[model samples]
Target: AIFSVGVSQLNASLAHRIPAREENILPTFRKALDLAREDADRLCHWISQDVSEDDFINWVTGSVRRMWGKKGNREVQAQFESDEGRRSVFDMLINLAGYSMKTKDILKQCDRVVEGAVLMRSLLKKVSHN
Candidate 1:
């Protein structure tokens, strides 16, 4: 979810910079955008599933390079290599994993607490009957 927000921000940032009449460039830009979102979702999944931090970071670094690498349309590639693009990627790498993991842990703890409360309530009802 956090990654989705980041992607939205990225899309908005890119949309503002790229001119509308550059229809030729838009396809490449859209493809890159789709790839980025997919990568972010995969990374988020890895984080929530308890992938090692070192492994996660390694994948992110490599993925960013591949995504923004020199092989694509020069204009598209240059856009991704720009400061705004780098910043967005950086934010995702630094914050996304940590935030996802923290959220997963918090949810787990909440579930356990709720389960305990339910058990306690059941026990209390039995005791009250006695």
Candidate 2:
């Protein structure tokens, strides 16, 4: 109860910062996180109405990294320990919020599935001919 609220408040607070400098992998990661986060909020809209995938991912990712004694944040790594120390990290993705395999890969997979089905059917035809 209290913990949940504390985490929520932390996310709400972080949301405003929206790092502008852009990390190297932010494009794909941010997009996936945003989508996943949106879906999560939509899922939770009825129950207290204040949860997002972004929040969950950040919380989990940040917490896990902190626990491992390895921040894993690029910003933290780069600065070593300066004012910009926070900027080095790529947002943690514990929630696994968004992005499912790339589109091109998915299409190729679908194509393979179709090919497999066709091959199976052809195998049946050969068996019948024999």
Candidate 3:
């Protein structure tokens, strides 16, 4: 759960650069950002379906671990915790901000990464019961 939000925030940070510096990264960032938005939606859906906070937390944590496990994007996954994880997130945020997005909304977007994590937790709880 924490990790998903971190990656989304990192994706935002890494995307703020102008094309002249490294044009290739822009497209990757675009794809990454799209995925991040999807994650947030998933979070909202999970939250809507659930009733227990502890179950929700475990679900988000476990779901994120499983998803990242399959995807094998360690750098992306690490953003949920650790020093390097945070550094990467900061780098992405800097990049995104450079691209002229509103600072406040961007921060909110970064923070909103938690929403996906929350949703992931909810989904897992549902799965375990069935």
Candidate 4:
């Protein structure tokens, strides 16, 4: 719940900082932002359910892959693969960790979460920059 709220706040901040001129943004970047918002909502929904660790890990991995697919070009893909991108994704997981003490099962999949975060960071960076 806390993690989802943080994600929402981050996304809102990004949306607000970007120019209102939609024409200046890449079509794929816009789609990535939309997908990210949807994912945050889904994460909230999932948190309320009695989901297994495996299921949660799958969702994390799949969502990251979906976001990566939204990369518009080589430049965007490269950005996703950059150090900043990796850091952002890991930071999200760190935030999640703070809220997971009550649900220790989720923490059991830390390795998987880290894998997904590596890919997710790129999508986050791409969306943030453009």
Model 3 pairs in collision: 13-92, 13-93, 14-92, 15-95, 16-95, 16-96, 59-121, 60-121
Write the residue-wise lDDT of candidate 1 on 1-130 in tens digits. Answer: 3444445655775677666556655665676678787887876654344323343334334433344343322422233344332223233333323322443578865654554344334333333343
Candidate 1 deviation (Cα RMSD): 23.1
lDDT of 1: 0.44
The Cα RMSD in angstroms, rounded to one decimal, for candidate 3 relative to the true structure is: 18.0
What are the per-residue Cα lDDT tens digits for candidate 2 across 1-130? 1123333544554576555335534554555566667656744542232323343334334532443235333332223233322221122111111111223587755654554344334333333343
Query: What are the candidates' C-alpha RMSDs?
Result: 23.1, 24.0, 18.0, 18.0
Candidate 2 Cα misplacement greater than 4 A, ranges: 1-104
Model 2 has an lDDT value of: 0.37
Q: By TM-score, who's the top model here?
A: 3
Q: What C-alpha lDDT does candidate 3 achieve relative to the native structure? A: 0.46
Residue lDDT tens for model 3, 1-130: 4445636665556656534356766666676777778787876554344324444334435654454343323433343334331222223233223322333586665643554445434455454474
TM-score of each: 0.24, 0.20, 0.29, 0.22
Looking at candidate 2, what is the lDDT of residue 28? 41
lDDT of each: 0.44, 0.37, 0.46, 0.46
By summed lDDT, which 10 consecutive residues of candidate 3 come out lowest? 84-93
